[model samples]
Target: MDLHYSPFDFAIQKDPYPVYKRMREEAPVYRNEEDDFYALSRHADVVAALKDSERYSSKNGLRLEPAFWGPQAEQIFSFVALDPPRHTRLRALVQSAFTNKRVQALEPRIREIGKAHLEPLLSGDTFDLMHFAGGFPTDVISELVGVPEADRAKVRDLGMAIMYREPDGGPVKDLPPSAMAAVGALVGYYTELTIDRAKVRQDDLLSGLLDAAEGEDRLTPEEVVSILILLVGAGIETTMLLLGNAWHAAAAHPDQKALALGGRIEDWVEETLRYDPPSQTIARTTVADVEVHGTVIPAESRILLMTGAANHDPAVFENPDAFVLGRDTAGSLAFGYGRHHCLGAILGRLEARIALEALTAHIADYEIDEANAVRIGSSNNRGFASLPTSFTAR
Candidate 1:
């Protein structure tokens, strides 16, 4: 097969690892002039770009969708699209809310949510784990962010639309009308939620952010709304993929599944992130001319950090394609790097760990119908839209 890479292409989406491996070995600095982006596939180059925020700035936007650039994007993205001081200021405000103690405190609730979904699935022979993956994360995040139960369904649907329309979604440049409507709906809903929470002060992350302050410096309504929108997008998508990929990996590799069954699910979870990261790519625009691997990326040009490829770079990990336990994942870029490492990293890992624990404990044996699995072609991440599986109840 040709070693072409296109996130929007379903062929590449089904199995990107082989192409990623080729990119690392053959075109370490792969260029897609047609797509208007330069891709870095090697671990050394990718990590260097990730850390050098001064040159390869995320200020343009980290999403693979180039349309999500500009002042307007920041208004909705909050700190995710900002550089240094601005990013630092906004990120610090909410840092306390996701602290170790606080995230650990949510484990009981996360476990409860995880087990609730598993027990019912245990009664059935065939089920799509994607529902559990998609539902559990949103539920936990919604409750944490104080989204009222009555409104969660509507808001969750809007969030999905805002990211990607279901059933053959179109390009970002030509987003469906419903997705466009979702864009507005999300901002309005979050704006109202932030305002209401500011007044009532509930005991949830939303209220916590409303109270997130440093003397006179506090989160403005716009900032609060932006964070809420970001939380919804980031919180659900990646965590869902993390869970989906973990189960998929376990099913594909019996050695890993045996390990998971042997109370080594944590190792499986980490290996899953490294082997198949929920987020495959991170985009940045050059603020200044930079040279990498003898390839000079010009200023104002787009750079696609091939994190998915880097996770499997042979120089970084031995037998890079294999999902083996106890592999050294110290330098894995799964949660990102430098100033933009996911703030929800702790929360995401905790959620995946608990969910994996529940699956291994309750579902004794399972096999995913990969031939018919629902694959969603996304701009930045790769994951199943539905993973139909037949399982044996424990």
Candidate 2:
């Protein structure tokens, strides 16, 4: 079957793997002339491209369009757009904060936050999982980044507004005034907050960023705001979608869900990430000519590393379509690989595991209303917008 991959297609959002499967087999290195980008679908291609920063340089902004790419995106997006030493330098400054020890230390607080949100929802028969999962991460991120409690609601609202991107190939800076205003609000909020945290010195990520002096390395004020926005935006939206996807996967495969409930919730988290990752595609621009599957992509070309497609590549797994418990999902591109691997992988895993365990503990089994469920669509991300579920009290 010939494949047409449109990120905005709601039909594609409904069930993208079949299309992805065809892309992997038929057109591993597919080029969409209309969209004017090259897609690398197969597991091997995607993995190689992600690690080959020299050839498929991320320096030209991660998105397709120049309006949101290049210099404009660099201003706000920080290191995701850079390559090698620059990317390495900026990453090193903040990498210590997300170390395994640090993420482990935050487990108790993650449980507390998870319980506080889920407790209220158990009172009702039906509730929106996204709504419940959304704020928990934002709250945790807010506390970590020193976002004041009083302003978290507004911050989250602004974050949601900034998160929405038009499907059209336009620059985000050219987005609607409301969206632009929300960006402005986030910039202003963080600019002031960065300055405040520098002086007060709280035990938060922002404060650590202020004083994290590894020899001569340190972050500029503007750089701090940029990274904070990147972390806050990526941290909240992706994990929020992940929590919903976990339930979406469980509802679709009852047997796997049942097996997961038998004290193996972490496997469900891993499988959910493999099946419907919160991030479907990670975009990049070629710094030089690169060849994949006998196709030569010219330098300055836009490339879409289809992490979603690669996750289900049949060559790498036994049954890519079906959800099974405890499969060997090694080399999973869900958190990505290479120089730009996800910084929050551990943190995201911790949060999702806690959320799922708590949900299963509360209601041994829950039915997801798939007919009413909505999928989150974006040029760069994928997952559910809302996953409503009902369960009898245990």
Measured by lDDT, the strongest candidate is: 1
Worst 10 residues of 1 by lDDT: 165-174
lDDT of 2 by residue, 290-338 (tens): 8777889999988899999988988897788788879998857988898
Can you write out model 1's per-residue Cα lDDT over 1-394, one digit (the tens) per residue?
A: 6668766566666788899888988888888866778899999998998888888887767765544665556765678888888888889997966567878888898899888767777676998999889888888888788899899888778877766634355443335677768888888888888878877997788888888887899888888888887876689888988888888888899877877877887788889899999889988889988887788888998888989999998888999988898788987999998888899998998898898888877777889998878776677787878999998877
Against the hidden reference, what TM-scores do the models get? 0.95, 0.94
- Which pairs in model 2 have colliding backbones? none
TM-score: which candidate is best?
Answer: 1
